[model samples]
Every structure is written in structure tokens, then in C-alpha cells.
Target chain A: MTSIINVSNLSKTYEGGFQALKSVNLEIKDGEIFALLGPNGAGKTTLISIICGLVNASEGSVTVGGFDIIRDYRQTRALIGLVPQELTTEAFETVRQNVSFTRGLFGKPKNPDLIEKILRDLSLWDKKDERIMNLSGGMKRRLLIAKALSHEPQILFLDEPTAGVDVELRKDMWNVVRDLQTSGVTIILTTHYIEEAEEMADRVGIITGGEIVLVEGKEALMNKLGSKQLTLDLLTPLEKIPESLIAHDLRLDNGGTNLVYTYDSKSDRTGITSLLNDLSANGVKFTDLKTNQSSLEDIFVDLVKQSS
Target chain B: MNLRAIKAIYLFEMSRTMRTLAQSLISPVVSTILYFVVFGSAIGSRIQEIDGVGYGTFIVPGLIMLTVLTQSMSNASFGIYFPRFIGTIYEVLSAPISHLEVIVGYVGAAATKSTILGLIILITAGFFVDLQIAHPFYMFLFLILTSVTFSLFGFIIGIWADNFEKLQIIPLLVITPLTFLGGSFYSVSMLPPFWQTVTLFNPILYLVSGFRWSFFENADVSVGVSLSMIALFLMICVLIVWWIFKTGYRLKD
Candidate 1:
């Protein structure tokens, strides 16, 4: 895969001595969905802003499609479509006009068919003649997507794309993104929703405090750090955990009716079979046993905590 | 700026402004009619003539300029400020349109609105008084120059403003007062020598005088000086706007 975006030693420092981004580097490949996960004010927006030419980077350099972002701004901007976190369509403008105007902004000749296709793809064709202010929030978000995609950009940046969106819109947007990916358009998405990252991202980059802590394949990150929980329901309630069973690092809950054990999923010995044998030997019998796999949420929380 | 992008922005901005037609065109016509009733009749009754022109006819250009300045400033500032207030500025800035294209598009729309209003006021003033145009060509020249200058000035205000209140600050405190005190109702010659000298500092004085010259045929100041001052003022405003766009001063960061 070819690299669509390359950042080297990128940092951003605002006035009055506030550092929004530290020295960081990242490479986003073409035709893949890359998710940047971070908490609020973690420089996700700032980084995206710099790449979009909305803000100037204080230090370092970035190139989009082999074009330096600052020097070759026109070409770079033409190559990239940005769906900012804000829902900022012209309120009084018809949806079709807004999308068409955006396409013309790139100096592209009028392409009514392309505009119609974009609006239809985003499910906004029905409201093509409606004013933007009359549309609901989800429709407005989709309109933003349509406007960004009107020029048929090679790469797209979605800054907090699904923030404050309904579940139906979220799912709908996921389908739209999946469609874009299938068409070979590279996507870089920043999201606070770990589930979104887990479901959509081919690779995940965890950023904390203006720095990228780790960038790895989604499954690899989970397998390296994800932990699983095993719960055993007791046949009868007990006062406390037995002294002999203290070596298992199990926690008793609900008046000792259940025992929960957490261990690394990647560990060679999960200790489940041995713990069950020991429990039987010690006369601590359970009527049932169940295991729950760790989710991406668990792995994300652990990564952010360790990095921070 | 790419001509295609600028043209697109220009068309878009114009459509947005036209959507508020009732408030844009009708409001000004109504207000101009009120000005004819209140200022032209009530004030004209007490005063007969100034500089050999009837009181009613003499105040026509100034009244038109007043409408032109205020309307242009309001339209331009609100047109851009609303997008920022609603967070649509990000969409505009992220587009392929250059800063210059954005400024020209918005300011051009504002100039169009104000020019149209000025023409309406001129026609409305004719209904109240038989005003004679001494130089129709110069009248068009001054009208266009004043509208463009104020439109650009309002563009700067739009970029600097952070909120709706900030957007109205210049129109309320600066543009309106300047028009009113800059001899919009009376000639600078009517004031004392010291005051007249001070009036020279009011930029709108040149626009008012320049516009009035085209109506009254002969005024205290030569038409050449008034037109020269207005032209120079427009050039300075254009330069500043260009610098603002080039630096990305308030609009970008």
C-alpha cells in the first residue's frame, strides 16, 4: 500500500505557552480506514486542522500524496476532503447547491451528475431542494459528507464523524464509509468511540496528551493487551474466600455466590483448568462456569491509562 | 485567486443574500420612504436651501449614501459572521477557495446589495423632491466607489468579529456615526473652519461630498478632489483587505 499522508516531527504550540501537539509522526496508507483514538483535547482536531490547512503547525512538516501541505496547499487540498466536526452547511442554501458549489470550489467544472450521485450516496437526494436549516441533525451531517465527497477526493478525513449522532445515523454513516473504502478512497477518522474504531479501523493509533502512544493492527493491539474474565457461580453462598484459594487472585462477589477471575488472554496458561481442579480439591464447588472475552473498550482503556 | 473558485463563491454568496430579499430590498425601500417623510419634509420645512439647492434636494445624496453605507456594512458583516457563528466557516476555509476569493465573493455581494439600495433611495428621493443630477456619470462613479469601499471595510469587520454582537459593533458605532456626522445631512462648509478641518478626517465626508457633487452640480469642494479622495480611500481599503487575507490573521487561526 502507498502512503497517502506522512507527518514528521509534527508539533503545535499555541500562544501563551500551551502545547497542543508534541513531536509526533504518523503514516496513513491509501485505501484503508485508519482510526485515531484519543480523549478530548488530545490534539486530534489540531492535527487534523494542520493537515487541512486550517491552522499552521508550529514545527515539523506534513505531506499529502507526496505534496507538501504548506507549499502545495492547492494540490494537497484538492486531493483531500475534510468533514469537520462542525455541521456547517449554508443554512439557506439548497442541499444540491451547497454540494455543487463545494465541487466548483476545487475549480472542477460543473458536474451535476457527480453532485447527484454524492447526495444520493449520502441519502440526501430526497432533500436536494430543501434548505439546509430545515434538515435534521443527521441529515445535516450527511450533507457535510456529501459536500466533502462532491469533488471525488482521493483521501478523506472525518473528524469525530459520529459524535452526538443517533444510532441509526451512526450505522448509516458506517455503511457510507464502507462504501467509500470499497471505492479505494483512503480514510482517516478520529473518534472517541472505541467500538467505531474496533469495527471500522484496519489499524488503530492511540494518541494521548498530544502524542501517539501506539500504532498497531487492531487485532494485534487487542491480543497484546486485552484481558478476559472468568466467572463461576457458587452452588451456595459463603462468608468469605477460602485461605487456600487466595493464591488464585479471585474476587468474591454477592455474598460469595460468585467468584470472578481476570487474566491475560495471551498468557500461555490461563490457569482456568488448574483453578477448577483446585476448587474441586478444596471442596469449593460451583454449579456453573462461564468465560467472557475482553472487548476493544477494555484494551483501549488499558492503553490510554498506561500511556497517560 | 482562481477565477472559477471566486466566481462560484460570488454566486453562492449572492444567492444567500438574495434569499433574505424581504429584509434586504424591501426593508431599505421602506426605510428610505420614512427618511423622505421625516428628514426631507419635517427638516426641509424649517430650512429653505443650502448652496443654491433646495433643502429637500440637497439632502438626497447624503440620505442615499447613509442607506448605502449602513446596508452594505450590515449585509457584508452579517453574511460572513453568520457562517462563523454557526461554525460553517470551517467548511468555507477548508474548501479550495482562496482567502482572496472568499473576501471578494462576500464583499462583492455586499456591494451589489448596497448599490441596489442606493439606487432605490435615489428613485425614492425623486418622489419627494425634483432632484437634478448635475453629473450622472460621476454619480454612478461615486456610488460604486462608496459601496465597494464600505463593503470591503465590512468584510474586515466580519473576519474580526467573533460573535453576532461583535459583528454589529462597527456598523453601529463606527459606520453609522461616521455617515451621520460626516455631513450626511449638511455640507462640511456649513461648519466652522476648525470643524471643517476636523471633518476632513472623517472618511465618509469624501464619499458624501463626492456623491453630492454629482447632484448639486457645483459644491464648495471641487469634484476632482472629492473623487480623488474616494478613489484613494478605496485603494487603501483594498490593500488592507488583501493583507488580511494573505496573512490569515483572524480568519484562519
Candidate 2:
């Protein structure tokens, strides 16, 4: 797959010698949802801002659709849509007017049909004529997405799109993102919400301390680092692990009513058979057994901790 | 030249002016008429005439200039400043429009509004006093030039200011006082020799004198000098704006 956006060794150092972004490189494939997962102040917005031409990078370069962002700024900017983290919209203008004006700002010819379609898709059609200040916060966020889509940009950058949003709105935003991807628009989103990235992203990039720690397919990343836990409900309570079953790393929980054993799923040999034999040899009995796999959140926390 | 982008910004600004018609248009027009009623009547009755023109008529140019100066600056300053305050300026910054297009659109809309207001005041003055334009062309020339120049100046203030207090500081404290002291209501020549010479340093004097000369063919300073001073100021404003965009000062981090 061809990459629609490329960042080659980009770095940003703000005034007073504060380094916001270290030397970093990334490439986003066309028509895929690439989620940048990072903590606050990890230069997620900085990277997006430089690519959108809102901030200049101190070193290296970026290109959108094969055009250098700084050299062909207008061309690159015209191809990208940015939904900023801030809810910034003209309060006095009606929703329709605000969206239409953004189209004009990109030097795009007026297309009422396109504007209407975008507003409708974002569930803002009914409130098209209402002034923005009158709209609710969720509506306002939808309006921002509508504005970003006004010019039909090929790449969309959503900087913390669902930040501070309620669960319903976040779900709604995820659907909208999926629809955009279905229409062949590349998506790049920055989020601190692990669930959001896990739910939506095709590929995930983890950024920490002004550096990209890892970038991999979401499913692959989860599978490679995932661990499984098996819990056996004891027939009766026990004081401690018996000497016969001491070889297996097991912990008694629930006042010794449950035996919990953790093992890596990726390993060829899980040692489950050996552990079960040892438990039987020790005369330990279990009424029930259940297994759980670690989620992306656990992997993310572990990865960040390891890197730090 | 992205005409569409410029039109987008220009129309957006103009629509804002329309939305605040009472504050942007009516207030200034009403205030200008009050100046005619109070200063033009009371002062005209006593002084009769100054520099061979009726007091009411002589102050007409000054009144219009005062209104135009303040309105143009306030309009342009507020037009740009509000976006920064609301953080909507990022929309324009990230758009495909060039910096020149942004300036032209904003300053153009502001100058257009101020010129309209100035003309309206000129017609309103006709009701209170007999007026004639010695050089009709120069009247409009000075009017448009002043509006555009000051609008540019206001744009600078908008970018330089980080807060509401800073936005109002220049227009209220500096520009207003300078307009008054620059002989907006009276000729600078009326001052004593020493004061008159000192008054020549005031930039506002040239703008008012040149504009007044366009009306009655009378001025405190030569027309050429007045025109050149305005041209010089316009150039300086342009250069400063250019530098602002080039360095991304107060705009990009």
C-alpha cells in the first residue's frame, strides 16, 4: 500500500529550548485509520500542526500526497482536513454558513450539494440554519467534522476528536470515522484513550517522551504482547500452595478459594497440561475454570512503563 | 491570487459588521451628527468662521476623519482579534489561503466600511452647514487612503495584542488623543509658532490637513507633504505586516 503522508526525521523545538518533538519518522498508508496514541504533551498535536502548516518544524520535512508541505503548502493543505482539539467555530454564523465558508477558504468552488451532504452525514442537517452558539457541545463537535469535510479533503487529521466527549458522541464519532474511511479518506487521529484506538484504528503508533516508541498493526501488536490468565475455582479453601504443585507459578486468591495462573499465549508450550497434572497429583480439586486474555489497554500500559 | 479565499474572508467580516449594525454603523453615524449639533452649532455661532470657511463646515472634515480613524481601526482590530480570542484563527492559518490574501481581505473589508461611514457623515453634514468640495477627487482619494492605511495599522495591533486590554490600548489612548492634538477640530497654524512646529511632528496632522485641503483647499501643511507623510506611513505599516507574517510573530509557535 502506498503511503499518503510521510514524515522524515521531523523535529520541533520551541522557544526557550523546549523540545516538543524529537527526530521522528512516520508514514501513513492511504485509506487507513492510523491512531497516534500518546499521553498529554507527547507532541501529537505538534506533529499534526507541522503537517497542516500551522507550525514550522525545526528540522526535517513532511509531505502530503507527494507534495512537500512547506514548498507546496497550498496544495498539501487543500488535500488535508484538520479537526482541531479546540472547539473553535464562528458562534454567530449558522451551521450551513460556517461549513460553506470553510469550503471557500480552501479556494474550492461553492457546492451546496456537497455541503448539504456533509451536514446530513454528520447529523447536522436539521440544525443547519441555527447559529453555532445555540448548538449543544456534541452538535458543535459534529459541526467541526462537517467543516473539515467541507472541501472534500483526501486526508483527515482529527486531533483528539473525542476528548471530553460523552460515550454516545464518541461512538457516533467512531461511526463517522468509519464512514470516511469507507469513502477512501485517510484518517490520522491522536488519542490518549486506549479503548478508542483499540476500537477504531487499523494501525497504532505509540508516542512517548517526544519519540515514537512503536508502530504496528493494532491486531498484531495486541496478539504479540497479549498474555492469558487461567483461574480455577477451588473445591475448598487452602492455606497455601502444596509442595507437589510448587513448580507452576500460581497464586491463591479469594482467600485461597481460587488458583490464578498467568502464561503467555504466544508461546508454543503453555504448560497447562503439566500444571493440571500437578494440581491433580496434589489432590487439589476445582469446580470451575475460566481463562481471560489481556486487552490492548494492558499492553499499552506495560509498553509505556517499559519504555519509561 | 485566490479570489475565492479572499471573498470568503471579506464576506465573513462584512457579515459580522452587519450582525452588529447598531454598534458598528448606527452608533458612529449618530455620534457624528451629535458632533455637528453640539460642536458645529455652539462653536459655529461664536466663531462664525475659521480659514474662510464656516465653523460647522470646517469641522466636517475633522469630524469625519475622527470617526473614520477610530472606526477603521476598531473594525479591523476587532475583526482579527476576535478570531484569535475565540481560537478560530487556526482555521485561516491552516487554510490554503496565502497571508497576503488574508490581509487584503480583512483590511479591504474594514476600509470599505469606514469609507461608507465617512460618506454618510459627509452627506449628514450637508444638512447642518453649507459645504463644498474644492477637489472632489482628492476628497475621496484621501478618504479611501486614510481608511486603508489605518485599517492596516489596526491589523498590526490585532496581531501584536495578546489580550483585550492590549487591543483597545492603541486606538483609545494613542490614536484618539493624537487625533485631537493633531488639529482635527482646529488648524494647527492657530497654535503659537513653537507649538505649531511641534505639532508638525504629529502624523495625524498630515492626514487631517490633506483631507481638509481636499474639502476647502486650505491646510496647515502643504498638500504634497501631507500626501507623502500618509504614503510613508502606509509603507511602514505594510513593511511591519510583512515582517510579522515572515517571522510568524505572535501567530505560530
Candidate 3:
């Protein structure tokens, strides 16, 4: 995929001398679900704001759809839609009016058909004429998406769309995002929910302390940093691991009833055969064995931990 | 030009006024009526006329100017300030709009509202006082210029203000006071000599004098000076608004 959004050596330093973003560089593919993952105060929102033209960068530059964000602001911003983290709607405005207003702000002609479709897709059609203040938290969150999609932007930025949202709604939003991606809209999201990134992103990026620690395909990241574990539930509790099996990395779990062995899932030599033989020789009997592969969350935790 | 965007903003603001019609329209109109009923009636019947006009007729232009000044500022200030307060300003900032378009949409809506309110009050004032428009064109031109200029000023206040209290500070403490002391109820000639000299310095005086001259062709100051003062003030407001967008001041960080 071609790069549709490019950030070249971007930095943002606030008036109070708080450096929100370091010298950062990134590129988002033309049509992909890219998740920017980070902990609290990791500058995720700041980066997204700069690209959307909501915040000015102190140094460096960004371009959306090959148009410079600042010099061709109208062209760049016209191609993008932003759902900010804040649940900010015109409280007095009806749902339909709120969504339709955004279409105009994004320079799109009024199209009630498109507005109806968006509201219906988000399950907000029934509440179209109702005041926004009357909607539930989940509905309000969906309204943000509907408003963002009003102008049919080629790219959408979801800044913590699922934050403070319930699980069912989050899953529902994940599906909506998937549908958006299928419809050919590139999505870039900033989130602290690692699972959110895992469940939706084609590529995952980990940021820590204003810097990107790593960016890779979700599966590649999991495989690269993910470790697997084989837990041996023994019939007899061992006093200790015998010295003969010392070479194999092992640990006692469940108060000595289980002997767990950990190894890189990607590595060819797991040494399970040699460890089993050595275990038998030492009378370390096991009734059952089960293997567990690490998940993206595990890799993310490790990556963030290492960076910070 | 972003005319569609401008229309959206303009209609959205007008809709807000429609939603609260009592407050936006009726309340101001009622207050103007009260001023006419009491000050223009009870007081005017006893006080002598000034500049060959009845006391009731003399205050008509001042009342409209007072309404336009406060309404323009509050309408425009509140229009922009509410979005910033609620955090919907992000949508505005990220929209594909130029700063001029943003100002035009907001200030235009504000000026429209205030001008309409001013006109409504003028019609209402005629019921209480004998009204005349020596130059109808200048009457409208002065009203519109004052509205647009003060609406821009209110836009600045909206951006500068961080809280509700700050929003009310300028319009309430500074502007309302200046309007009252700047001959809203009496002619500048009625004030003592030193006070008259001091009142001449109030910008609202020029606005009031210019607007009054459009009606009665009698003003405390020359129409040229009034026109120049308003033009200078309008230019200054435009300058500040430009700086705000260029620097991203309180709107962005």
C-alpha cells in the first residue's frame, strides 16, 4: 500500500515547556487499520491532533494524501475526518442535525440520504430527531463516528473512540471499524486498549514516553516477542527440579504441582524431547501437558516495559 | 469561500436563537419597551427637548445602539465560546475552512441577529416616541457596521475567555457601563463640560452619535469622525482575529 499520511520529524512542545511529542516520524498506508498504542500521557492524542490540524506542531511537517497539512490545509483536512476523544456534541441539537452539520463543516453538500445511512448503520436512526443530550453514552460515542463519516472522508482518525466504553459497545465499534475498512477508508486510531488494537489493527504501533518503541504487523510482533509455555501437571509434586534437567529453562508453578517450561515459539530447538528424557530419568512424572502461545498483549506489555 | 460551511454555521447559530426565542428576542424587546414606557413616557413628558427633538425621540438611536452593541458582542461571543467550552471546537479547527470563513460565518450571524433585534426595537420605539430617519441608508449602514465591528470584538472576547465569568466580564462590566455613560439616556451636551470631554473618548459615543445622526441628523460628534472611529475599531478587530488564527492562540496548542 502506498503511504497516504506522512509525518517527518514532528515535534510538539507546549507553552509550559512540556514536551508532548519528541522528534517522531511515521507513515500510514493508504488503506489499512493502523493502531497507535500507548499508555496514559504517551502523546497519542497530540500526534493525532497535529495530523488533523487541530494542533500545531512546533517543528517538522506532515502531509495527508500528498498535500502538505499546513500549506494545503483545506485539501488535506477535506480528505480527513476526526473523532476526538472528548464526547462533544451540540447538546441541544438533534442527532440528525448534529451529523448533518459536520458534512457541511467538512465542505460536503447536504445529503440526507448519506446522513440517514450513517445513522442507521450506527443504530442511531431511531434517535435521529431526539436531542443529543438524551442519548446514552454508547449512542453518543456512535454519534461521533456518524459525524466523522458524514463527509465520506477517505481517511478517519479515531482518537480513543472506545475509551470509557462498555465491552459490548467496544466490540460493536470494532465491527463498525472493520466495515469502514472494508469500504476502503483508511483508519488510524490512538488507544491504550491493547486488545482494541489487537482485535482491529492490521498493524500495531507501540509508543512510550513520546517515542515509538516499535511498529510491526500484529502477527509479526506477536511471533517476534511472544514466548510459549508448556505446563506439565505432575502426578507427584517434586521437591525441586533435579540437577540433571538444570540446562532447560523451567519453573515450579501451583505450589510445585506443575513444572512449566518456557521457550521462544519461533525457535526451532525447543528441547522438549531432551527435557522429557531428563525428567523421566529423574522420576519427574506428569499426567498431562498443555501448551499455551503468548498473545499480542503479552508482546505489547514487554515492548512498553522495555522502552520505558 | 466555504459558503456551505458558512451557511451551516450561520443557520446553526440562528437555530440556537430560535430555540431560545424568549431570551434572544423577546427579553431584549421587552426591556426596550420598558425603557420606552418609563423613560420615554414619564420622564420625557416632563424633561425639555434637546436639539429640537423630544426627550423620547432623542434617546431612540441611543437605545438601538445600546442593544446592537451588547447583542452583537454577546451573540458572537457566546456563539464561538460555547463550542470552545464544550470541546466541539476541535471539529471547527479540523474542518476544511479558512479563518476568514470562520469569522465571516460567526460574525455575520451575530451581526445579523443584532441588526434584526435593533430594527425590531426601532419599530417598537416608534410606538412610544416620534421616530424619523433622515438618511435611511446611513441608518442601516451605521447599525450594520457597529454590529459587525462589535461582533468581531465579541469574538475576541470569546476566544480570550476560559470560563463563564470571563465571558460576562467585558460585556457586563466594561461595555454596558460605557453604553450607559456614553449618552444612551441623555445627550453629551447635558453632561458637565469635563464629563462631556471624557464621554467623547468612549468608542460607544461615536457609534451612538453616528447612529443618532443617521436618524435626526443631530450628533454629539461629526459623522466623519464617527465613521473614522468605527472604521479604525473594525480594522483593529480584524487585525486581532487574524493574529489569533495565525498564532493559534487560545484556540490551539
Model-by-model DockQ, in order: 0.52, 0.76, 0.81
- In candidate 3, list every pair of residues with a backbone clash: none
lDDT of 2 by residue, A131-219 (tens): 99999988999999999999999999999999889888888788889989999999999999988888899999998777898999988
lDDT of 2 by residue, B1-253 (tens): 7789999999999999888877777888889888888888876679857889888888999999999999999889888988988989889999998889999999999999999999998988898888899999999999999999999999999999999999999999999999999988898878899999889889999999999999999999999999999999999999999999988888877
- Mark the regions of model 1 whose C-alpha exceeds 4 Å error after superposition: A225-294
lDDT (CA) per prediction: 0.85, 0.91, 0.91
Q: Write the per-residue lDDT of candidate 1 for residues B1-253, one digit (tens) a residue.
A: 5677778778987887777778888878887778778877887788867888887788889889998988888888777778777777776676666667777788888898899889988998888899889889989998988888888878878878887788887788888888888898887888999999888888788788878889887565677888888778788878888887677777666
Model 1 chain B weakest 10-residue run by lDDT: B91-100
- Clashing residue pairs, backbone N/CA/C < 3 A, model 1: none
The alpha-carbon deviation from the true structure for residue A115 of candidate 2, after best TM-score superposition, in angstroms, is 1.0
Clash statistics: count for each candidate:
0, 0, 0
**Candidate 1 docking class:** medium
Alpha-carbon shift of residue A34 in model 2 (angstroms)? 0.2
The candidate scoring highest on DockQ is 3
Residue A78 CA displacement from its true place in model 2, Å: 0.1
Scoring model 3 with DockQ, what do you get?
0.81
Fnat values, one per model, are 0.64, 0.81, 0.81
Judged by TM-score, which candidate is best?
3
In candidate 2 chain A, what residue range of length 10 has the lowest lDDT sum?
A: A218-227
Which prediction has more favorable DockQ, 2 or 3?
A: 3
